[model samples]
Target: MSAATIGGQNGAMPELITIDDVRSAAELLRGTAVRTPLLPCLAGDPDRPLWIKPESLQPTGAFKIRGATNALLRLTKQERERGVVTHSSGNHAQALAYAAKVTGVPAVVVVPYGTPQTKIDAARRHGAEIVQCELAVRQETAEAISRERGLPMVPPYDHPHVIAGQGTAGLEIAEDLPEVELVLVPVSGGGLLSGVATAIKALCPAAKVVGVEPELAADAQASYRSGVLDRWSAEQRGRTIADGLRSYLSELTLAHLRARVDDIVTVTEDEITSAVGWLAHNARLVAEPSGAVPLAAYLNRADELPRGRTVVVVSGGNMDAELFAKLV
Candidate 1:
């Protein structure tokens, strides 16, 4: 497909991210984030073998490190001195905190109340000042903190740098499996999905890029099907077990999804739990519910997916110990 076909010719379309942007991000992330391995899934059918990109192996046990590190590194010296702020349910909060600690910058994080204790502890361990609020007001609270402290806001997603950094994962996938026919990515605010889809589409145009989401929190899938940026209420999305996948997609990410994504699928809650258990047992990979959504979609909706070599991105592993034990 041509760029014009995916990215509309109208001037309203936002500046689309290119392969070059992903390359630059890869360069920036070379020494900062781990190059997660692409391991073959021994449990998957031999007829349609599956590969897993376990981003959980990162220092923060999540893919958020890639974007967080890149964004923090790009800050000017003056901006760094002033510090950075962001709002996240968990993973990005820890990522930013860890990045700030390593870069010698103060960091403030606004997190939703009732977030997994493990994630909150991880952020605290990195020395981030934490402010708690309802998920609905988390963004406003973070913005207020940023303005009050004169700190730049490192948004969890939406920014070009974050998307570019996340795209590096796609670049690795493409490089490792040049013949990969299908790529499954779990969607939340769509940064990872947007970046990965953009990179995969550019590097392997013929490969199918599918975004997976929990059926209870399927706002991204709804937006893709409607061609309108559909959003779900915080209460509605909070019904899912996948704590990290509750956020709605931003306009920037919605634009990329509309252009580059082949399809969006929703997996049931049961399937997500099953996937988490399956990965632990068969792949010996610890996956949070949000991270297991792609594998869930693959296992439950195989009839709808393309048959061939497939890759699923296990986005994070930051579940509470109690929850992990109960689920697995």
Candidate 2:
């Protein structure tokens, strides 16, 4: 779902992309990007034979690398020289760090203090300087870092090039299975949702784009319905089990999700925990809460989905295993 211009402002972000963009991303990332497996649903929703695009198989155990790599690769020589900065919890930070490392560009990551230690080590392994701040102060921290370093900020999901690159996932899914009817994408700041929705809608007009979020942290769903950033009350947001869903909506991402997604559904913390267990125990796949969102949606509202072909984009697989073990 490529976003419309920011309130009719020109050059803020681009519109729906062309096939050439997907092909270009594929070409640029030919040797680097993993052709992650899309397995037949192990859960076997008998009504609709589902498929799981297990992006956990991707390098860094998440799908963010696809967009991050393409974004950094597409940069001009001057842009590359100045380096890049980003604010991310875990997945996107690893993705950007790996991308910058591969392209020989310096990366400074402003991470939330709550980010898992494993993720911090991963970023350090890729040579990204870590600047830690409180989770709620992400934008402010990232902005300060950008000013001090004079580096280009590589927003996780709000940028056009980033969205276009992420859309490649939907384009590939469509190419791989022309009969696909439903595609479930996990939403966070709405980058993957917007990109996948745009690609799916453009290619398979009849297909439904479903966005899933944790019920405790369903601010994106709220924003989609309200046509504005309807953030949760401070109390509710503070208690949501979905720590990764700690940010509010971006105007660019919110507009695209509302216009493109067929429906926005939510899952409880119990359902999310169950989904993670299902992936780990049944499918032998290690998945974080955000990664297991599709499974949560499927299990929570299996009867609501169309009784036809369905595809779920498993967004990431970066759980703190110890934390999950306690939950289970």
Candidate 3:
């Protein structure tokens, strides 16, 4: 854990994302990203009803599209002509590729080895040139590609535009369910959680925004509790079933989380798979392991959370066919 705030080395405080930033991103995403519905969970309790925000319904089958499109839309024409580069485990890779295709901007994606082939194929279908590298060096690899190609690097979660774009989902959640008392979001690189927490806290002041993650990759939980940014090695985070939640946080995301998020919780791998199964059977939603984690926390850690109308963000549905078949 590092106690120093991000940008502290230069005596500068990192700017925390605000509700206005999220609203602007929402504007940028109006027609491009899906304004996914907040559907009632059929199996939810009568007293504490649960709603599902299915970002899986997005064009790219994930919430990453919101940020990816926003970032790309904000690019200068010259930048767009030169193209863009990013590193993602899966979801963001597909998102950036799709956004680039639609916007006529060329894209290159550096993916870590062992990423789901389903996601890789999806990105390729959208016309992104794919590069493979070790998980530890994925970011550096993207930077190298950007340097060599003169493409602007649109990071998966570390950038403000990306974070603000992900926050649009939170804006919708707040708008749709202003009375919501608890909002559950999956945390990996902290972009979604940071943005959602910012929007939810601003729009629904009384709502408790909680971040969920696999216990196998609970660096976010540890960091939230300690008020310091904690890091886990790639090998350690890779132990979880939730591949999308394997990445750790950045200084910008950590700052937003510390300021806006109420709590961070962890769930077991079994619980995560169980939640995925439940969503398939009960909610009729095919949530990937990463997307199912918010529901996992709600199902297993309810006693630790507030009681009220709750919303779980089903972040994405991009799963390997074989794995989806077995889980569902």
Candidate 4:
């Protein structure tokens, strides 16, 4: 059943995304973004083995390119002329910068001060002007810049275009693993999780969609459980080593999570670190802590999850060299 069918039972549907939107985004991203590979985990259960979708292979070293490219492609000529601005902790910043550079549109990114240097450098490399701000004020600062410069804001998440673009990852997963039974997606702002869940549910309705988050930054899990939007203080979320999973979800993403996600799970700092190491050593993939959360869930909470062939979305790999060395 489609989200539209489910939304009708609840009330007037909010502007949620659809499968068609995802297909359109896929068309736009055909030559721009990488259609990352899904590799098998040698150590997983033979009968119900795990596969990893390494989105870190994208040019910006993350899956953010898909949504960023789609959002930019949809911009009107007038809007493109005005340029674009948005806030991100890391991956999305680089994604938008790369997308803007390729499309020949100027871009400005407001990023949290403590974001890894590697991500910041990647954004600058793509010709995007960088604006630094405290975690609490990143969005406000981006909005201020947008208003002052008459730049249209392409939000990191919460927009239909962004969500639809991210959903293309799910479309690929379903197409690659038609008989797959479960998917574990790392959740931060919920764009990736929301988009992946929507596409997976629409294409493979029986497949379970699960979200993974760091226990310290578990706002998405809290919001999913309470049936209300919940947020964590920046300081609280910053306590986790998974810097990319700090943001809270918007109402639009929360709505998608509610409608499509089957379960939300939390992993500890140790699990994240171990998963990062495992990805590098066993899977030959360099995964940032945020991207490792889904694998952490698979390893530490397998008993809690449904029995099936599982696919873990390794969302990004943009950690500092020293940090990567220390973790892996």
Per-residue accuracy of model 4 over 205-294 as CA lDDT, tens digit each: 999999999999999999999977789997899899998899898778888998999999999999999999999988999999999999
Q: Which stretches of candidate 1 lie over 4 Å from their true place?
A: 1-11, 116-118
- Residue-level error in angstroms, candidate 2, position 228: 1.9
Q: Which tens-of-lDDT digit does each residue in 156-261 have in candidate 1?
A: 7878788888999999999999999999999999999999998999999999999999999999999998877889987899899998899888777889999999
Worst-scoring 10-residue span by lDDT in model 3: 1-10
Compared with the true structure, model 1 gives a TM-score of 0.93
Write candidate 3's Cα lDDT for 71-115 as tens digits: 888888898888999988678888999988988889999998988
On lDDT, the stronger of 1 and 4 is 4
Native-to-model Cα distance after best TM-score fit, residue 300 in candidate 1, in Å: 1.6
Q: Is candidate 1 or candidate 2 better by TM-score?
A: 1
Scored by CA lDDT, what does every candidate get? 0.88, 0.78, 0.89, 0.89
State the RMSD for candidate 2. 3.0
> Candidate 2: where are CA atoms >4 Å away?
1-20, 134-136, 233-235
Q: For residues 1-328, what per-residue lDDT tens digits would candidate 2 score against the true structure?
A: 1232333344343254455676677677655568776678757677778788888877888888878888888877887888889998768899999888987989999988877788899999999999999978987999887778777778887776777678778877888877889898888678788888888888888999998888887888888988767877767765656555555667777777877889888888888888888887767787778888877888778776655788888887777768778655
Worst 10 residues of 4 by lDDT: 1-10
- Candidate 2 shows a clash count of 2
List runs of model 3 lying over 4 Å from the truth. Answer: 1-11, 113-117
| Highest-TM-score candidate | 3
Task: Give the lDDT of residue 100 in candidate 1.
Answer: 86
* lDDT for predicted candidate 1 compared with the true structure: 0.88
For candidate 2, the per-residue lDDT at 138 reads 87
Clashes of each: 0, 2, 0, 0
Q: State, as a TM-score between 0 and 1, how close model 3 is to the true structure.
A: 0.94
Q: Flag the better candidate by TM-score, 2 or 4.
A: 4
